[model samples]
Target: MNILKKVILIDDDQINNFVCESIIKNERFAEEVQSFEWAENALDYLKNTAVQQPEAFPDLIFLDINMPGMDGWSFIEEYKQIPEEVTKNCCLFMLSSAVDRKDIISAKSLKEVKDFFSKPLSPEILSFIKEEFICS
Candidate 1:
C-alpha cells in the first residue's frame, strides 16, 4: 500500500523530475506523482486544487532551490499566503543541486521546509521520508 496519496515535484530540471518520479513510483511511495517545471505553475496548481479539490492536494512536495524565475525561497513566500487548511498537511522539502552551506542553512531555517536534500532523489531517501514524515 502506498504511504502517501500524492506527491508533487517542482524543479526546473526535467531530468531530475523524471528521475525523482521514477524513484517515487518504483518505491510505491505514493499513489500519484505530479511534476512541474516551473514553481509558479506548481503554486498555481496548489492554489487551484486547494480551492477546487482539497482532497487532491499533495501530501508531499519536493521543491528545487534554484530556478530561472520564482526560486524556491520566493515560492515559499507566496505559498505562505495560501490558507493553512490547504497547506497544513502538506510536507515541503528542498531538493536541490546547490551544495552551498548557506543554502542548506537557509532551508533549515524555514519552518515550512521539512528538510533539505541534495539532487537526485533516491529510493532509500524516499523510504526514509515515508517513515519519518508520512508514517509518523
Candidate 2:
C-alpha cells in the first residue's frame, strides 16, 4: 500500500540518516526521502517548503531525540508553531536509542508525536506503523 509520498529523517548521525533513507527507499516506503544532519535545518526546510511549496511537505518524519543544537523534544516545541498546513498531514515519530521511560512517556504525552521507536528503524516496525496508522 502507498502510505507516504515523502519522508524526512532528522538525525545528527549521518550513518543513521543514510541507513534510514536507504531503508525507506528500498522498502518503497516513500517516493522521496530527505535526510538532515541538523534539526534546525530540517525545521527551516519544513517551514520554508510549506510556504514556498506545500506539496513538498513530508508525509512522515523520523526525528532523533539526541542532537547538538535542537534535540527532538526542542524541535517539537518549535515545530508546533509552524502552520497547520505544514504539519497537519505529517506523522511525527520519535526515533532514538534512549530507552529511558521518561523519554517514552514524554513522547507519548505530546500531541504532535504519533509514536516513539528505538533507533535503527526496522522494516517490521515500519510495516506496523504503516498498517496501524497510515493504512487504516
State which candidate has the highest lDDT.
1
Colliding pairs, model 2: none
Cα shift from native, residue 129, model 1 (Å): 0.7
Question: Residue-wise lDDT of candidate 1 within 42-131, one digit each (tens)?
Answer: 999999998999888899999999998899999999999888888999999999999999999999999999999998899878888877
Off by over 4 Å in 2: none
Task: Provide the lowest-lDDT 10-residue window in model 2.
Answer: 1-10
The whole-model lDDT of each prediction reads 0.92, 0.91
Q: Count the backbone clashes (under 3 Å) in each candidate.
A: 0, 0
The best candidate in terms of TM-score: 1
Query: How far is 105's C-alpha from truth in model 1 (Å)?
Result: 1.0
